[model samples]
Target: MLHIVACIKQVPDTKIIKMNPKTNTMDRASAPAILNPYDAHAVEEAVRIKKRYGGIVSVLTMGPPPAVKAIKKCIEIGADEGYMISDRRFAGADTLATSYALTKALDKIQKIKPVDLILCGKMTIDGDTGQVGPGIARRLDIPPLTSVKKVEAVNQEEGHIIVHRKIEDGYEVIQSSLPCLLSVEKEINEVPYSSFPNMVKAARYEPHIWSVDELEDVNIKQLGLKGSPTIVAKVWAPPKPEGGKIFEGTPKDQVDQILSVILEKNELFQAKGGY
Candidate 1:
């Protein structure tokens, strides 16, 4: 049976997030965290693929102790097993360090059983950079594809996979070998409702937690904040724009006034039938 693992993350519920003006960081305690919306779609797609092809769908996440809940969310979404890599040493990780830690954990997961495919969301809302999926692929020396919109086909015996990739203005179809990583977009799949049994399993499931020492060839210089090259030198809330003039009039009068003002600003708008 094919072994598929999906990487997921937990992020602060950004809709209700509070920011710290002093440190210019998120006020995490003020907001409830949830499984990343995009990761949820990735897990859903992996589960669907397993259901069709017959395989196990496992999830792995690296975060603080609270991140275990994100793994459980994957279980609730129909994953069979979940792995969590939590440690103080993993704190303040940027994409580079985060992928390093994830690569170490994935190495452990592969040792027990060879993984056929690794799935990930295109990007995390908090980080905004969709680099971790490809980063993990780089560390593992596996082929990685990003912006996947559809899994056109999979051939386990011949070791082939075909997928549609999202691109500006259109899409592209590409084929690659197996044991590959795919970073998928949300439009690729719909997350289904979790079965009761799966919900129970997820609630009771304990993930395989690993520490810094557990990694095979981990370099302390590249495992956490120290290993990360990027840093948030400064941060602040978006500055509100200056006050604006509000125009009020009937629909026709308003249009005329607006056009007059616009034409006044730009002389090019004076021509008839001109945009």
Candidate 2:
């Protein structure tokens, strides 16, 4: 049976997030916690794959206990199983440290049932770094395919999967062996509304929660802030742009005014080759 693993996250709603200047951290209380948008798409894709291929779709996340909500969200989306790695030691982890912790959990899960494929979102909206997925792949020693736009095929018997990976101009088709990692773009799939049965099942579903101690062969130093090398020295919002000048006049007059303004910035236009 194909066992697909999706790495998901519970991130604060980016729309209402605020920074804590004093600690260089996010003001978690400022915004309601929600499933990461990109990860939701990953979960949807995994569920679709499960439906098509007849396998188990498992979702995993690393966050505090409240992150159980995110796991439930995956269940509602049709994931068969959910796992969460939550512990005080995992708090304040940067992408690298977070990846380390996640890989450990994945290793344990793998012993229980070998995973055929791993999926992740392109990036988390809260972090926006887009590094953790590839990081996990590196730690797991698997091929990393980022920004996947479509899943072309998953040949389990042949042990390979074909995908369209997004590139600068358009996309590139990739065929990687099974057990590879895929970081998917949001355009890959649309998450559909949950049916009544799924909702009811999700309401009663409980994810397998693991603490740092529960994870095998874990390095104490690599689980949290202690292992993070990149430090946020400060967190602050950038200055908002000034409002544009509104010229109120006839169409011809407005055109003349715009021309005058452009003339004043002719040097900038020339420098940017916008002339």
On TM-score, the leading prediction is 2
Clashes of 2: 0
lDDT for model 2, please: 0.93
Q: Each candidate's root-mean-square deviation in Å?
A: 4.1, 2.5
TM-score result, candidate 2: 0.92
**Residue 222 local lDDT, model 2:** 87
Q: List where candidate 1 sits over 4 angstroms from the true fold.
A: 239-256, 259-275
The regions of model 2 sitting more than 4 angstroms off are 19-25, 249-253, 266-275
